[model samples]
Target: MRSNFRVALIAGSIVLSQVFAVTASAAPSAHPERSSLVEDIRFKVEKFQLDNGLTVILHEDHSAPIYSYHQWFRVGPRHEDPRRTGLAHFFEHLMFKGTDKYPGKKWERIIQANGGSNNAFTSRDYTGYYEDMPSGTLELIIDIESDRMRNLNMKQDEIDSEREVVKEERRFRVENSIIGAMYEALFSTVFKVHNYRWPVIGSMTHLNATKREEFKAFYDQFYAPNNSVVVVVGAFDSGDAKKWIKKYYGDYKKSEIPAETSKKEPVQRGQRSVTLRRAVQSPTVMVGFQAPKAGHDDAYAFDLLSNILSNGNSSRLYNRLVYREQRATSISSWAYTAQEAGIFNITSELKPGQDVDRSLMSIYGEVYKLRNGLVSEAELEKAKNQVMTDTVNQLRTVSGKARALAAAEIIYGDYSAVFTDLDKYNKVTREQIQNVAKSYLKPEQRSVIRMLPKE
Candidate 1:
């Protein structure tokens, strides 16, 4: 799923595009007692496991009469074989086609009758489905979700139709958008061994080649109760929620989930680059560096450094490249974290007739200065404040809190990390930031993608 959360900056007259999913928004002010807030949030959360190995997490919020119910499965594009790249994502669409009990359009009609909305998204690491409904409708959503989890009746015709729908989605999102194409190219060139090298939306050839049996095998393998997490947030009683979860999900049997033995991506020994000629208005350059995994200590420092470089107009890259030099129209930097190792990326859209080489040098110069410990104490403080404030803002929403809890559990193996991670960010020192920059942001460890306007 593409994350709705992002931290952004505007450079000169141009606005930088958001570089990462799972980012935070601007906050009113930094909360000094963030630990208390974390504790408060933790207190409201209730977690338990069902006999069938189904994991359930619940959060009660009486402020509103609405709630969000989400189910996150540990299957995504990363679980697919190289030849069958898009099956995981394609199944996301097929899931909505309905089971025998619910049938076509029946599930959606029931949700609409109750004035609720439902949707799902697939990412490289997980697939998530959620429903936001008025509090009274929680049981209804749970029943529908639980029914489909084990009883989905897939038809050959539905698969055929949805396959085309996925193809059209790819056409709109990746094939037609310059930035989208650049993102695909960036990962493809960055990793040689990992499945992350492929986009979440599988290629047209693979989608067309997939068979119905393959689809059934995938569903049976990864969609088991043991391989998923169920989260419910908003106005609800924890006890009632658990009872409902057990009633609907307890009887489902856990299947034998297979172990993932994908080859580990080897270390990069030199800079890699790819050039794409797209029909666009301006030339865009994207640079990526191999970075630490999500739970790693240095990831926090990298996150802070990304904010310092491009979180706002006052950021280093915005002021340097957009205002001071006026060579680039916009620039953004982000450290993307996943279940495995992540990518730290910087992207710039250059002005007409600007020197790409010169812009690259200017950006690298600023980065090298960070390695040299030129970051002042004030700048470091500002970055920290932004990170903390963003965290507070994210926790303010029910869906946001639920997503954080689910992602933390699925990706990091600890839901408490959702709260403790802020402290990790707070503990990051200027020295650590400089050290990470020196260690990972080296010339040989980077990849460059230049998208030139097609002649």
Candidate 2:
């Protein structure tokens, strides 16, 4: 799925693990930076479960005459067996294929006629579907969503068609793109046991060979009401909304959703590197190291460090590699906080004639500075501001609000954490940033992928 919104990863795990099984009804903690502002901004959330095991989280916003209806399934690439992959991504496409009642193109048309826009995304942690529609169309959306969930007509032809689309997607997003190819290689090299090493889109062989029965079996097992959370944010009448939900989804049966526990990767003892010779204008390298899941305290430290390293030309890596030294044309870093242990990535495209080894050494040299000494107070403050800005921007729309609520519930394992994100980041000390850099960014814990220009 192509969309105007969203990119990559399952939300990295942290502060609250899935064991907590959070209900969104709790009050949010105050924002110390501005108590009045945090106190004034609150979401009146209603969290409940239906008899059939459907979990619903509602955030009632009456300022607008529309609602963001999002359903998040706990199934993702991490849930699949090694032999069978990409089924989760397949269902993202399959969900819209429709049941006998609505069937084929009719499903999208109804939403379009109602002045709504809809899209879905699949990640390593979970799969989600959403529709942003006028509040008046709540019942209709509910009825149709229920219909497709219980009565999806899975067909061989449709599966075959979608398979080709997925294969092409792999080509476009992975094989043909330099950054994507490097990441695919980086993750696979870094993770040996965890499915996080397995790309969210899955292996090409699995996509080409997966059968209809296998797809249906996966759907029956994982696509249950018990395995998902439905979020309705924006303007909607909660009273009427609950009624429509029950009328449509009340009687649906819950399936025995499988436990998604997979093997965690064993610790890496030494650096692992993959080198590629490709036809390109410039050589590039992507180095990845293990970082904490979102639930860990260090996850926040990793986030702040990502900013300090590469947020702008003023940051460490950019200032050293791109601007000051002029060893590379570009440089950046990301601390991916997936549900399981995450990855900290630093990628730089070398100046056409620059030395790859030197470029890599320079990248590591700046990281050494962070480990050797604490970042300045100014650097830390700028990182927090950048992070806080990104968080606020995500909530600029009702759809973004629903997405955040869904991620908080499913990805963070606690919806209330969404409210305290600023508090968490603000609490991260410079020492913590240095400590995480020392702990996780060791060369032994790293996996590097270098792409060289072909002869």
Candidate 3:
């Protein structure tokens, strides 16, 4: 889920300049380069489970008066019944609507009056609600969250109203957005059996058809302590925070959850592609190649592969397709690290009058070549260092640290997975990068989508 976990950006304009530095071989280390100065990474965490089986992690950082509160639910669109494709996303919006204990909009008003900010997000694997506010008001924050979890008041009027809001959101985020449209089409065609094919924001068609009763049923099924994690980070005492948490959330009943193991996708027999036409500015192509999930050993190498290919302007896809080949105006790629499975995406926004098919072929050719040839040790190190720097910087901010720990604990089953992840990354050899490519980057494993400008 997008959640409140932020990927912090430090002052790296100098590093940004080297975005077009991709080469047939890696550059020598002797080239003058300056590492961005980063703050110390430190967090004091208290981990425990409540009587009802709610997992909680608290990070005490008194550096500032503000704190970040997050409640991450393990269940997301993956757990949703196929009939309720967008229920998770819908619930995300409705959570802000008041509950029985705190009726009307008074709950949010109370928090805002106390100087706080809040938002939530839904992904394929998780839905997270979070708030950032002054540390002194931590109890109020917990109170608000606890009330909503157990005492949500879902009136038929509110449900009908919010459903329309969700439909409009889909129109804005999916129907109108070109890349968003491409993402939906690509994933739908790519994953045969996996629930990943369904977009988290859900289908407007399904949302409109959903009954009020079904929405309440969805809330009961997934919104429980057993499937959630509460993370509070910033200036606070862990002991006091835990005491208040129990006082507020201890009464929430544990609900029985269904055993959830879904059928995995079979090996790809061949390449897949889709086309989306809309009133867009330029022709765009999205290419996806299936890869291992986040914790899989291959995930680290795939991440490095993404960094080398398209992490920044200096990366291969950008430098080659945009600057060197001049195939399109801009080119970029992303290695999406989702919960269960992932994809390496190369996106090219074509130059006016440029051939989209030609650009797509050239980009695919580079990935194919990488599979056949081993990347140099120098290239591998460059990618590794780049990721390390980003990771360290992400942990520097208080909010960042909290999010890192929270995501690690909820997503990977332990906060230590964050550090362990780095260790695994450090052990990746250049050969492993080539191996993942050879195994996962075959042309047949790809799903290509071209979003063309409306005629």
Candidate 4:
């Protein structure tokens, strides 16, 4: 089963630049220049919307006989009420339980019979479902997806069974796992008011208390044509795909979009700390600071700063703490951006008997240097290049392109933001990185969590 915990964790901090281009044959362009490649991608992408507020994006690539279909809903853990946390994530699993027309097991059986695979995941900001199948099965996929949008049939028994599954998932992912427990503690400490303080998997207490009627209410409110975007990529005719979408999804009525939460997290006045004693062999340290939201101006600089600090073997954290100082077995940093403000976290696993305080101080020393404008032009360029290369590599697959487009539309409001944001990274200067470091990474604004082995 796909879980939102990992997706939200990774997407929250990572700024994946959606960049690249492949020819109609899905082969790399022969020119090998960035400008030419970007233009090629711009030419291939097509987007349109239906009358009922359903947005559709299509990218035609006849290189392979396969394609990926994705439906992204703009609701996730962030949209859930604090009293009923994890409802959005619960629906991620519940969506597959089937509708009246299809019935249980029928959805998965039909897809597998057609040589296709389908799965979905939830995150803080969105929940998405996708299927990878041969080009011939596009209509079938559309038919099944559209039917379930307004017709999901959830009985009490199925709801109770899936509630147990989600509870077990929370046990395995958050309660039992040390790192998972640590992350939960860190977020709870970091944001006192924001719904993001809770894990997307939710708490067992809330999961158990949630009723069938509550689930239906959530489904009716957020799962509407207006709140969704359908993205189709790979080998398909755009005109035919549009016609199929109209036939399947055109008549679904749009529901009232929920008003966003107005609660704001108050600024942290002093450092907050937590310690967890779990069954583990090694100790770990995670230091997190509140940062700007996704698509915020400061977010781009923080993304580049995260890369410079710990992206590779040559990064400051890796070379100083993990290699040269030998205080840590591993060290890394991430800037998780969301619809609301996010966290910029640095995590380290220390070698046996290493001093956690000393290691944390060393990490702080590096961040302080960045705040002092110590980053060099070459270092900035190298980090940008690393991000660019990683972005291009991820976009190489059809599934990856589909995901990028969906994320762009969901998180940034325009599918073109995926391409335009590449320039934001390219334009980030050393001064901007230092300024963000100073503004956001202050010690008093940080939340520190240490997980130690229970003796």
Clashing pairs counted in every model: 2, 9, 3, 4
Q: What TM-score does candidate 2 reach?
A: 0.92
Flag regions of model 3 displaced more than 4 Å.
1-42
Q: lDDT of candidate 2? A: 0.78
> What does candidate 2's lDDT look like per residue over 1-455, in tens digits?
00111233432322221111122232233233553334334567888889988889988887889899998899888899788888898889999899999986998888888899988888777898999999788888888887877788998898889889888998999899898889889889988888888877888999988988999899988888888898999888889889988888888899988776678778788999999888998999998888777667888788778778887778888888888889888887777777777788888999888899988998888878888899998888776666665555556568767877788788766787667766777778889889988998887888889999987
Evaluated at residue 256, the lDDT of candidate 1 is 88
Residue-wise lDDT of candidate 4 within 1-455, one digit each (tens)? 00123354333223273323312334332221344334433536888889999999999878899999999898988788888888998998889988988875988999989899888888788899999999898998899999888899988999999998999999998889877898889889999988788878888889999988999999998899999999999999888899999999999999998899837889898999999998778889999989888788888888789878987798899999988999999887777777777888888999888888999999999988888866877777676666666556656678878888888888877878666656666667778888999899898999999999887
**TM-score (all chains, Cα) for each model:** 0.92, 0.92, 0.90, 0.92
Candidate numbers sorted by lDDT from highest down:
4, 2, 1, 3
lDDT of each: 0.78, 0.78, 0.73, 0.81
* Candidate 1 accuracy as lDDT: 0.78
lDDT of 3 by residue, 1-455 (tens): 01011111001111111122234333222222323222123345678999899999877777788888988787777788887688887888888887877875887787789888788766677777888888788888888888888677888889889988888878887898886788788778778788877887888778889897887787887788888899888888887899999999898899888777656878787988787888777798988877676677887777778777876677777778888888878776655556677666777899877888888888988898788898877777777666566556555556566666766776678876645555555667778889999998888889889898777
Q: Please state every model's RMSD to the true fold in angstroms.
A: 4.4, 5.0, 5.5, 4.0
Mark the regions of model 1 whose C-alpha exceeds 4 Å error after superposition.
1-41
